[model samples]
Target chain A: MKSLIVVMALSIATLVGLVCMRVQATQSGKNQESAVSQSTISSDSNSELAQGAPANPQTSSDSGRSLVLVASLTVFVLSVFVGFEIIAKVPPTLHTPLMSGSNAISGITVVGAIIAAGYKETGIGSFFGMVAIVLAMINVVGGFLVTHRMLLMFKKR
Target chain B: MNALVPLLYLVASVLFIVGLKVMSLPRTAVRGNLLGALGMLLAILTTIFDRGVTGYLFIAIGLIAGTVIGTLMAKNVAMTAMPQMVGMLNGLGGGASVLVAFSDLLNTSDHHVDTLIAVGLSGLIGAVTFWGSLVAYAKLEEWPQFKKPHSLPSQQLINAGLVGLNCLFIAILAFSHNSAIQIACYLGIAISGSFLGVFLVNPIGGADMPVVISLMNSYSGIAGAATGFVIDNNALIIAGALVGASGIILTQIMCKAMNRSLSNVLFGVMAGGGSAGNVDEIYANVRSTSPDDIAMILDGAQRVVFVPGYGMAVAQAQHAVRELSKVLEARGAVVEYAIHPVAGRMPGHMNVLLAEADVSYDKLKEMDEINPTLDSVDVAIVIGANDVVNPSARTDPKSPIAGMPIIDVDKCRTVIVIKRSLSPGFAGIPNPLFAMPNTLMYYADGQQAVLDIVKAVKAL
Candidate 1:
């Protein structure tokens, strides 16, 4: 538990450093729009986000467990609908880029990958986790950039 | 902070939806891309804060290395090679899910039935998607000599058997308590699933590559969704579902363009159909025209349409074609480009090619829009397109491409087909449109032919 706290502290420090760099970059008029958005979102949720700490399952009741599962299922079903509706209207001319673009979005698994890799110190587990992180990051970065490059070529009248 | 995490995730999901919505149009696509990227950033930050994740050293390394490599690859890939790049990215997504599920199973002290089921699915789908996408990349790049369709005897039976074996292994892994036994079962499931993926994609002909790639992409999304269930991550689940749904819709669109069902694409090779008969017999009555003659025809024509295909992409003729169109327009001809949905190797491939050549998006008409008035078109210039414009889809129900939606370029007053030879198209089927009296085949490479036509038109 102590090691876990130390790890978290280190990560917090790193995140702070990144935020500072982002602020500097933005001041210099670099393309740091994402930094601005990130700061805005973080500031809005700064207090409550820390309150939503991980709850140990040992103390949670069975009803709580079931409720979590139910909530997740609801989210899943609703997301499926949201996905179908949004993509249904995509023009045939944009299908390939869209596929690749959303492909990058699915790389959200990198979030899972980071937890898997860093949550434990076991050799085998960490190794697999690191591999996952790398692969998912590649998908995330490459897919979006490629989609952006392709979409930029298209011109309107 | 905890309450804020879900709210942030919800915001991120909405951004993704908006991004996709805006991406449907050419005008807002770049902004849409930015929105999606912003969503990703927000989601990643939320995960970090909510989970209170540690071990920054490795995370920093992986993130930096991946960003650098992925960015370089995205920047360097030529437009023609975009499909393979997409294939690689899809495979990586699947591979990541597989690893995540494997790690989750390893770390969990108590495996609930639901979690086990989710992990099992993650492993199975991820394995298939990974291997299948690799084969797709190989086929697209023609990296290995084994590009030809290779099917085992009783292929469907074998595929079904592999699937059954994989399911049984998953069941054993989930139910068994012995760590040793569970590990063995896990390995078994992965191996069988990987082989199944290879078998599934190996026999699919190159003509169906677009559908196969899209299907694999969907599998990767399903795998990610399964991983989300295992880890109980709302953002992952939402993102995965979005990709999966969109990919399925795209795959369906590809199948419809080719007049093929998904099942037909997966197992069509079992029939072992031969390539459409000899080109010699089909091209015997075809008349050949020179650039000068085509130029002469175009000089007097008022309504002209240019139909481009994969051949134009291969010869890099889009710019030349654009120039030829400009010259025709200068000669008082109302020139337009007709794009078949499945004209190029990938979906919207031809559009990207034409757009790169500075062709105005407004002047490019879809098959449905252009086909209706084809009869009124004075000159239809077909550059390296065959099957999509083939009249076989209309006249011969027995043809392989019959029922497929093709541009009705054959109905024009004069159809000028610019190709290197009388060779068949990617489908390996001879186009009977070449034999029509109104059609004149200009035997030349696509880029060279268009340039020649431009020169000849200038002289006229």
Candidate 2:
């Protein structure tokens, strides 16, 4: 009984903290806005943005690029962590519904990649862009197909 | 900054891919969203470094305004209204992405015809998804449209023509005497999208909106990601892709649960004579139970399964329901929760509220798992959910819900329904479960009624 009380108290505190974090983000945005001025802006406004942006110098620009490249690769690899977590915890019955719905959103990635490819100027860029489009297409087509299968659950016949 | 673009895009693409994959499952979809968000955050941070903070003050204000509205919408929106909220937000995402692409095109003076065409296409699509999704949202929320079963096939034809015409605008804008064509395309996008929104939602009944909402959410995410390409932003692309994929999967699942297709759920929408008033007229129902009778039902139960829905949420009966459950459990009866996927306004809505009332997560069982136990349970107490526990889904093939997955509360020995009135559910179908011989109807406000049940159980 005592433990239940403690848990209840903790849950309330967690809810409050989440709400506060949300409020704080809003407040911070407001504060930042009042700090800016319209008169000080220039034609090459991108320059101003770049100036104050992440001043921590990329330790050896070449190495920095390599580090970002490595980080990007690691990010993709971490998706496996996501994979393991979902399949293990999800109840078997909900698998059909959840998968079909999310698959539709996956279709958007293909559409995005297609537009990106269409805009590319170079042969290599276009080739990679085409690859992006194809991957996105696969996601879109596959998602729709899966969704169609799930709809069979509701069929009258 | 330029060198990082490729790597950043690669990471964004990966997040987009994985996020969609994870969204297919209810359990991990939330985690999938968080992971996709992290990838987008990385993309956003990278983009900001190279971005010229053009009119930084306005940008800041816009961001602040968007955040405030978005947060309020997220926190306060009811689960029942979740589908509508999803539709509105999706529309906003698509609209904003199109706006971003348009701004980019307008800022640059150089006439790269290919780039112009791409931006135009992106803008047109973004606008269409935005306005169209809004109408879809309105329909889900039951925005007071008087004409029932409204249909407009011509609107669809116009929409198709408008999209093609917008592409033509790009080609003309590339070598036109003035920028009128581009402006006209924007106008057409706004009009067509708005019209399409009405047409899409006009025929749709309230019942199938959860599925449509999920689908619209996917459209919104895809629009945002596609727009990201126009602006060459890695983060937006990743975030948009994640949201889009997950939305699709969720929509598919909802359709399956409803026994409908994405297309059917959207376009095969129907609004017929409301089943509630007509049923009440058809069968002169008699009140067979009082508060005392309800107390007796509670007194005799050895096991109970409580099913809650939007009506419970509307009643704000989480606290009272928890107390009632506790009282029943103390009476040496095993109590469990039957959580239907589409029970409340949104996914896990009842669970979240129940959790808020300090209900143990272990007590909640998904519908399929709980349905089997219903037959063995002495009593099933349905707080406010109607369609979820309806026997029609199981016994009658001609019923509106027919093959849609439902909790087998009809199998229970005794059933009690506490509701405001005999209002039909979002499915717009009458619940025969309410009229079953074994079931007792005690219509009142859910919160007060649950509290009464608690007191009755305590007296027992």
Candidate 3:
């Protein structure tokens, strides 16, 4: 019941935001400002949509959502434990290259988002979902690509 | 399509875990990152239709607007302020999450006590992180100086007082679930976060932007994760966790890069300001070398390691550097790029730069991995980078960066500096590395100098 309310509220904001975005274009002259505005809209759109109707039963509860959470949590715990085991001795020797590589991972999200967002699907929700996916894609892909080039320094000897 | 959400969630989570794990290893890190990113994309798409939509108007507008702005940011923002830009994005991310939490609060009417309470908590934490990041962004770009009151009667007390009142309002949220209370909390936290943000970052010097960026990034992730709990989103939960874990790791890396503990940096607790002797005057006749002189040196070298810094980034000379590397490689001289932990304006700043020029991922080397090779690397090309390559960390006790690890570039057969001026780097300390016996200064813009060197090598 509460989840539905949250989704409904989000949908209203997204609707309002979409309308207000027309104003944003006219009001803000800067492109980044509009980009910020775009993020503003999508941030609301999904939550609103998620709460509005019967979301995939899987994402609606912790018990059902346990798979991904379990995977991430277990890894997080292991990383913490392992990281501590090697604490202060890791020497950060691999930090620069690793950062570059992870940043590249952040870049790869762009491809997925592009695929989803650029196309039109039967459901309007899916269509907008695709768009949001595209935006997310840009963030991930761009971030990772940059990272790869940075870490290239550590390749071999 | 409905089942797609869970499928993608599982996939994204696995990728995130694998990507993060693989990123821990240098050789497969890039590929791991790419896979994780693909997972995130899948999660994002799943979440999009998680909310049912009636029209495509908003979607279309968002795509167009975000694309245009992101493009401009990519094209226009100078490389020197990339950290600030990255911080700005974090602020935006946290800010949106906070606002979404607030909107959820506004929508509550029939009084689902649990939901209202969750949203309130999410809002408070998210607000702090979002607004806090905004202040960090401003400091990195507009004000690169540290600021703090030498003696404040009760700085901590005042902030605590405001936050206490904010918590009082949160109690009301449990009973009433009112938007008005939500408004008050938002205002309270906004003011408090602004103060906390200034207090946190203002005392930090410009040299620590990477840490500041990572810390802020951590805050952003926490905010998003908190919001996930409020919304009960499987995708949000997973995405937020990935971001949070990665952010925490980034902070750790950033802290290590500066050779300081995160706790020490955060509490205004520092070991030393810097090595004073590093700045002590030394008499040496400084002479500038032209592109031809550098070319001759490069041509004769058996191996070369090009160390790109913010100067190289400002020069936008990645292509020339790549071409020069190819030239050296053709002549049977091994070429590699040396990346310092904190070499550029932001974390991974140098990597992004070189990739923009299409340099392959196979030729870069980490500081630790390459430092041992300086003894054999015939020439160490020092571009616009400063502090990371500075030699004082090893010898000076009074210096701020004393005891911090730095590249052993001075150990190389010869060092060539490509810069436009003698101005000090972020640390405001003159590099003795520039005046070492085998070091030669090439006073020119990085791109022009590298291009010139490429031409000179051709002539040779």
**Separate DockQ for every predicted complex:** 0.28, 0.04, 0.07
lDDT of each: 0.78, 0.54, 0.57
TM-score, cand. 3 vs. native: 0.69
After superposing candidate 1, which stretches have Cα over 4 Å from the reference?
Answer: A1-63, B270-282
Q: After superposing candidate 3 on the true structure, give the runs of residues whose Cα lies further than 4 Å from its correct spot.
A: A1-157, B1-12, B15-85, B109-117, B139-172, B175-179, B267-280, B285-293
By lDDT, rank the candidates, best first.
Answer: 1, 3, 2
| Residue lDDT tens for model 3, B277-362 | 53445315455688888888887899899888876766778888989888998998988888887876556667656655666555
Model 2 misses residue B181 by how many Å? 3.4
Model 2: which docking level applies?
incorrect
TM-score of each: 0.88, 0.68, 0.69
The stretch of ten residues in a row with the least summed lDDT in candidate 3 chain B is B143-152
RMSD to the true structure for each prediction, in A, is 10.2, 14.3, 11.7
Q: List pairs with backbone clashes in candidate 1.
A: A48-B1, A49-B1, A49-B2, A50-B1, A51-B1, A52-B2
What lDDT score is found at residue B390 in candidate 1?
81
